[model samples]
Target: MNRKVTIIASNGNLFDAYKVFNIAAAAGASDDEVAIFFTFDGLNLIHKDLHQHLPVPAGKKHDLERFKKANVPSIPEMLQMIQEMNVKLIACQMSMNVMNVKKEDLVDGVDVGGAATFLDFAENADVSLTF
Candidate 1:
């Protein structure tokens, strides 16, 4: 059987969220099944309109320019890369309701679910991480 990993993202911080996806993608590439559950402010990661807006790292000088110049992946690009690698991205339906975000507003391929749904994935995961 394949390994299973679940990542729960609750904060909206860009760096942390980026790390979660990066790790998950690496695990998936190793033949593990990875699922990322976005809740609370983390749901912003899936919002179609907001996905492309990369947050600037605080106290970092010229970091954005360096990243751009090096062709580092943007948040949206990272998300797309995860999807292309078959990593599942799930957005919390309850959070979306509270945020007044519609299904159409989420990025393509996002699976919408509630707490129980995420818990199911967690139950079967060999490794679980909460961000």
Candidate 2:
């Protein structure tokens, strides 16, 4: 059976965005259908400039260093990998309007959509998660 996974990324934080893309990439690599929706603050993750520079919390400096030391891919790198893995990335149209984000502001290959579009995909999802 085809296992479908849906993830909603609602935060703009670096780690959260990384986690969402990482999970989607992993799932796609495993041959599962994977889709991610970036909503609210998470929309920033796909912004051309913003996606390149996600801030690390002051308290998490050591964690960032450790991740770097461990060779974890950067957020932008992970995003590229997700695309390479064929994971679907969606940007919420409603949130985009509220945030004044235009289609040109987002990375290439992201589908612009609304709740109904997400729901259509979610209807067949065997697993759904939000970060």
Best candidate, TM-score: 2
Off by over 4 Å in 1: 69-71
Q: Model 1 residue 24 lDDT? A: 82
State every prediction's TM-score relative to the real structure: 0.88, 0.95
- Collision pairs in model 1: none
- 1-131 per-residue lDDT for model 1 (tens digits): 46899999887766766778788878878888999999888887777877677455587647668868988678877888889888988899889999998889998898999889889888978999998
- The Cα RMSD in angstroms, rounded to one decimal, for candidate 2 relative to the true structure is 1.1
The lDDT values for all models are 0.83, 0.89
Provide C-alpha RMSD values for all models, in order: 1.9, 1.1
- Candidate 2: pairs in clash: none
Error of 1 at 109 (Å): 0.8
Expressed as tens digits, the lDDT of each residue in 17-60 for candidate 2 is 87898788778888888889999999988888898888776688
Model 1 TM-score on a 0 to 1 scale: 0.88
